[model samples]
Target: MLIVGEIHTALLPHSRPLTPEEARGALALAVGETVVQWARPVPHTASPTLLHGVDCRLPLGPKPGNRHADDAAGGSSVRAVGTVCSRAVLTGGHLLQGSAWTAVAPPQQPRRMPWSYYLARPGTLETIGNFEARRLAEGYLLADGQGKGLARKVRHDGGTALLDAAAIARHSVHDVLSRPVLDQRPPIKTGSTRLRWAAIADPGEGRAVAFRLVGNDRRRMSLVTGLVEPEQIAAAAEDLAVHDWLLSAVAARIALAKIGEDPRHTLRTLRPVVDHLLHLWSAGARTSRDLEFMWDSLERRPGLTRQWTTMTERVRSQIDYGAADLAAKMLDMMEERQKQTGGAGEPHYR
Candidate 1:
């Protein structure tokens, strides 16, 4: 629903009378197929005024601040305000004897940058359409031309004025209801998980780097992080080669960022890390197999078993700490698991 504020009333065009159909199309209705009802005030017996004006409070959706942070930052606090103008015509109960009018001005247009050069940018049209659709649906009516004649007709009809008033109200309500409401929610991918990564260089002039693996939750982030180690970092520096699936995913993210003008280039530059992860997984598998043989030989001893468990956990922890990408950690875990299980099965890398 649209809750408009600051209505301006103006003189109706003195030239022509509006048809009933035109009047009916002027009333604003909320989204959906719901019918709108008008509440006219009782005429004052002592006052001889033919026209009475009122402000009808309509329920608008959530506050602008709840939807955008910029609105809150701008110091524009939205309050519950009457959006629709309600003007009543009172004439001996027959015809509307008095006239009332309200005017809605056009909305201001946003600033635009001149496109001196034509560039094929993704999501450009989609973004513009979304913005325009929202504005068209939510804007208020300023001056509906139907009010002039409807007011006069009721005044001429005498005591049956209430019926005329009802007709006019219906016409006004319909106009408000015709606009379309568009869905604003973005599309989501189901079943598949979204993984993101960031790398921060040390402020000091050093080769030290810190990496974070982000996912839907901290546990998932940590799980992905647990797949690599510092020793693996040197291998990554040599020649990082990633799987086709992971490489394509990272490439898509980079393309999206470039189109959106996102300043963060960390994701775009981290392709090498993925390559490094694939290399480590391949190298680690061989070492892991030898470790598994030693591990199985000492499995009968409880002390040795506990020691192996502690050592493996320590290795996993170090990998989580050193890896820049969560997917890389996952790849390491897959390789390790394969080796531990006697290379009998493949991991679910996807």
Candidate 2:
């Protein structure tokens, strides 16, 4: 059995005020710490993985063209759901199950010695919210123990209602956001441009669609956005150039590592190098010069490549260490800033 839990931090002030940036940062830190703490005891069960953080806000009511059919059928007006700051799944072993001592006892007991202090920080509230959202999003209605039917309740009912793992697997996030609805469908032609160029065969809708094209060349990288309506044509034509580029880079790295007389057999050797590239790309370091620098540094010296691996590992470790460090630093910063402004102890703005 998989045991899942969530933690949420309230944006609204309870005792002290926080800026939006500070609140967001605090929320992120709290979620990170909670996961680390949960994973500590279950070393064998938890697999190492990267975490993706999502901050989303769903606005109330329909956009200009798309209105919910349910509303026309006498449903209540849709309202904006509150902002959600959450982390995705942190999959691990069944350590939380089977033994009350390992599962309940540790969490119940004060690992840090003072439970009240843990509850006192507004950051704690943010942590809880993220955990709850993760639970609801991943655990909904699959009957798989990981999903607890929570997805059913939290699911949106309009254009976004049908969005689930299947849809996500089929479409990109950008596509999902830009999908057109029958109610608020744009005109077939807007000015000289045609909106619904062709009909989608699979979904059988003649609706227009937006496609994000990501590609890279020797000189530079590019992300071209296009609009198309035909379902199959759109899916196929949409450039996954960026993903392809990244994958090619990985393949190239693997090939290079295999070139020498003493070939590296294990993925562990290549994992760090690939991870470094991934980090750079994610950090918006897309220029050819940056990529060339990374490639050259890795290939320049064997020791440097090893050092790159070690550095990646160190940074990963710092995620846990840095959370604690950040929390403390933030507290100090907030306190000093508050003092300078002569508004110490005031609750943060909502």
| Highest-lDDT candidate | 2
The alpha-carbon lDDT assigned to residue 311 of candidate 2 equals 46
Q: lDDT by residue for model 2 over 1-350, one digit each (tens)? A: 11111211111212222233332232232324532223232111111111211111111222235554222122212111111112211111100110000000112222232434433321111121122221221222111112112112343532222111221211222221232221222211111100011111222322222221223221111111122221212222111222223334444444444423332232334544433344422211222321233234323543334444554554344444445565788899989888977985665778
Could you give me the TM-score of model 2 versus the true structure?
A: 0.17
Whole-model lDDT per candidate: 0.24, 0.25
Superposed Cα deviation of residue 3, candidate 1 (Å) = 19
- Candidate 2 least-lDDT 10 residues: 95-104
TM-score per candidate: 0.14, 0.17
Native-vs-model 2 lDDT?
Answer: 0.25
Which runs in model 1 stand beyond 4 Å of their true positions? 1-325, 344-350
Q: For model 2, give the RMSD to the true fold.
A: 26.0
Error of 1 at 278 (Å): 32
**Residue lDDT tens for model 1, 250-272:** 33433343422322343333333
